[model samples]
Target chain A: MTTAAEFQIEYLQYLQADGKAKSDLPSFASDETLMVNLYKTMVQVRAYDTKAIALQRTGKMGTYASTLGQEALSAATGAAMQKDDVFAPYYRDYAAQIQRSVSMLEIYQYWGGDERGNCYQNNPHDFPMSVPIGSQCLHAAGAAFAFKYRKQNRVAVTTIGEGGTSEGDFYEALNVAGAWKLPVVFVVNNNQWAISVPRGSQTACETIAQKAIAAGFEGIQIDGNDIIACRKIIGDAIDKARRGDGPTLVEAITYRLCDHTTADDASRYREDNEVTNAQELEPIKRTRAYLTDVGFWNDEKEAALQVECKKNVDAVVEQYLNIEQQPLENLFDYHYAELPANLVEQRQEVIEGSL
Target chain B: MNELTLVDAVNQAIAHELASDPDVVVFGEDVGKNGGVFRATANLQDRFGENRVFDTPLAESMIAGLSIGMSTQGLKPVAEFQFLGFIYPAFNQIVNHAARMRNRTRGRLHCPIVFRAPFGGGIHAPEHHSESTEALFAHIPGLRVVIPSSPVRAYGLLLAAIRNPDPVIFLEPKRIYRLVKQDVPDNGEALPLDACFVLREGSDVTLVSWGAMMHETLQAANQLSEQGIQADVIDVATIKPLDIDTILNSVEKTGRCVIVHEAARSFGVGAEIAAQIGEKALFSLHAPVQRVTGFDITMPYFKLEKHYMPSVEKIIAAVNHTMEF
Candidate 1:
């Protein structure tokens, strides 16, 4: 474990940089299915990222944000969270939603710009994907306050990019989280670029993790490529926040292996060397090596796992695409709690036209 | 008439609503010990105790965000923004988050957050304090906006806003908050948030307006009576839903229309009125709908203010222009 005087960088990490498994690591002993499930979910998210970029090229989805290199941060965070805990995802948190049993169709429909895809009609504790920069951070903080008010023991987890720190909502949320000692964890996945604007241009601060200092809360910077390390840090922050010790700002230091979204061309702004260097820090590859070395899996099992995951993804994709189209009239109907006069007329006009 | 100022009536409404519903809470900057900048929340913190009503920091976005979160958790949050202009920082929470929460969650979660902001130009205040941004909120989907003209409407409409399942932008007419006095029921029942109120009836022309402009619209109708021009005045309390039936029926009777507002003329609430008339009641009009609105300029200091505000004279002049057309 890397320890500093101000912050304790805890590592439940099973592997070192050389891909060797550690002898001692905390076990998720309560359930092995959950561990298998997390790995499967992460693989599914990676598949979705790859498929979504291809779809965007073919013009199916609009400006999609791919969580390619950052799956470990999202999956590990969601895996460490309590079952009943609420999760508010930013535009790129597909892995968190996937780990929560949110179908791939729902996530796809959402990034596709259908508000219905955002609706969690069945999920009891999931929020829609928020895209207005740092606005969702305040919602997470407020949810944490509500949980504390109702005496619920659930931690609220949400994410933002490093550039999101410049928004007023981010500071306001952190201040409220500090002042009220709410059970919320703000994870700043410092993927370097917030849509082409690099980290240094966004803020002169040495690190985004250091911003939490003004709010009287502590923060930790972690190597996000370490999946187990990300899991342990997120889990500790969640537990601490829920105990009413207040919120923690986690800066998962990582890089975006892909473009910001399919609409972007990183070649214009980013150098080939930068991306090539990030390839050496593949989070999935690191985790897989440890699993193999620790006798958790073999070459055959790994191949089999990939085949099963691809088959599952293909089946779901087919099912979702086969679904029929819905009418546009429902758009105006959901605009207000009850039908407005103008919308009522607008809906009638559309229906008449369709007829 | 049992008279009460608009500010007093709003305070009474909040107090009565808090008394009636245990789920209702109130908070904002200078809202507790200071009793709010306009004293609308005066005696509230003391009467309801600090938990139910209290002071929040100067963070407007966080305040609005907390309201949306609290409302989704089944609490009725009546939050205050010191001024209408200050709410821009919180527009993400108000417009994107609170307004869309219900539609985003399907039927699972509904945010019943009421944003009570003092608005408009008659008050010779700071540059930012005198703004009529009602049209902006009205343009957004999934939000209900209300602007009351007098004490009674302020009391009743606010209570209606408090009970709405979707978020409501309750813009109080700051200029008329301390100016107007009228009887309001203290029994705590609010009117529907989707309907408009017909303040005056005539058959020559229909005047559609809301908020502080309601009084000016009525005054214009009164002025037109001397020249034998009968003008029907309708106050669109809930601007988003825009009680189109009342407006269409009124315009259909008059065969002429004049939309009045204190917001800038271009792309303001008046534009919607003119557009709706053109779209829905085009054949009913003897002439095209005309609008008497504030000049297309930023709300300047107290000196150049009169030119920026609409009055009875301006409304009558617009009526004359529509009649000539």
Candidate 2:
């Protein structure tokens, strides 16, 4: 006789790609104002992304990772997170950062290579944007461990790309979170492309969510293009974590509709036909169709929303450009809480030489 | 006051910190119930409970990354790696995250974590167990690299590292973990983390060393005293922000300097010390600086380990060369 452990992975898609409702939505979906606000944030993030790319082309900004077709993951994540919880984000989390009160100018400043851009006046516990792939998952696990140790009802949520699932940090984090029963949730943004490498070539596993099973946790897949599904799934995972129900892995299936960064040329590696197909299933148009079907939004409202987003992006860009550069000592100052004798001398030498 | 070995002193310091501060936590592979491979964290689990002291999966990256995570949220994490050689897996986390967390966040987030690892070779351990790569960590800007030479310094420096508000890599010299004993007072007093301790003072030649090499350095100093060549021995407790002033002062009086370390000779902490002395005290030096260090080759097996280690005779030879010059 053979004994085998059977496992089932759940996939959620409440809103179809064509903006049609596939099933009855969650209670929060009935809140038209909340849905409209989420839609507006996505629009704002897209506008910022366009402006950033334009600035890079004009030699004004540095290389930037575009959120392009994957804004729903960040939108739902940022909206569902509470003030008390900590968020450890990856590089492409502009919408999430904006929702958490990190100003657009600050994000631009960070991309411009200014360390002071990470100094968020609000959400002091929030970690800086992790540029190193899946490392933020480990940080999320550690923060969750702190919450569990203190007996606090807070959860840590981290985001990673599909390619990041193959990293050792991702696997180890999920393992520790399961073994220690920490309150954490990992949201994998399966945008189908990690630079030139496609999602299929990144891992041999059936789905990225199934990788969590090896670490003994629940893994769920959701339609990342559907805002209602994204919010519901992330909110549920966060609630489960807050209830001390170990950790959960939510894989948001989406597509990267643009180059990885301003420095990368996707046209050299990817086909235009595939990009065109993905654009049809992008998040913004689907969400707009859903809102129109619900009678909550229309073409007139969208036009006005686009104009407002442009104005907002333009103002933030001006502020970012006009901001004064910090003194040179700022580089050596934050290295430690107090400068030691050697560093003090080095700082003095640098200042004197500059003078 | 209690007479404790270096390992016992490390345990005492960790337990003391865990008791005095509720936010302090300790964890590593086999560190909880097993009390660590070398028993440096012995009896800490029972005393501090499982919540404060625990075991983690056999993953160095997670150990380092978790410490970074726990530290930013008002907790002081003292994470132990099984051995210094195993720290390579967590190199990215250490250099990219732990060392840069403070500066990257511009002081908004800081990691108050202490990564403790048993380093150096002498006990005939297997490969990947013995390494003195202190220079690699010290090279990173945002980290404080500290090593303890004796029981008292171990206890005091560990307490200081645990209480420090920044990330610190506390390297415990495994070769001297129980090599000697000293009376350490449990008064919760911590030694400074950025200063050096002068073990012996003299005016003939300055012998600079840290970690386990201090043992042979002191022995060399004693032997040199018998030969009428009094040597000033300096234990560079904090290797990163080196106490060069103390070394320079000793060199100014002695007019000669001899550095010793067990790590590979190229780009070691000794090289940094020699460079600083050459730049600052070129006029005071009566003779060129000499270094007695391990070879650039990988550490050999148990039988040949003695030859690879910097022996007392080699230190004496370096001292003789500097004095004769």
Name the top DockQ candidate: 2
Question: How high is each candidate's TM-score?
Answer: 0.92, 0.99
In candidate 2, what are the lDDT values of residues A208-249, reduced to their tens digit?
998878888899999998999999999999999999888999
By summed lDDT, the worst window of 10 consecutive residues in model 1 chain A runs over A3-12
Which portions of model 1 show Cα errors greater than 4 Å? A1-14, A21-24, A27-37, A57-62, B1-3, B223-230, B280-288, B317-325
lDDT of 2 at A235: 95
Error of 1 at B163 (Å): 0.8
Cα lDDT tens digits for candidate 1, B1-325: 5578999999999999899988888989989988999999999999998878888778998999888767766788899999998998888788888887777766567788889999988778987899898889988888888998889989999888888777888999988888867787697878888888988888999999998888889988998999999988899988876788888899989999998898998988889878878988889888988888888888878898997888888889989988988
- Cα lDDT for residue A74, model 2? 90
lDDT of 1 at A269: 95
Candidate 1 clash pair list? none
The interface root mean square deviation of candidate 2 comes to 0.7
Which residue window of length 10 is worst by lDDT in model 2 chain B? Answer: B316-325
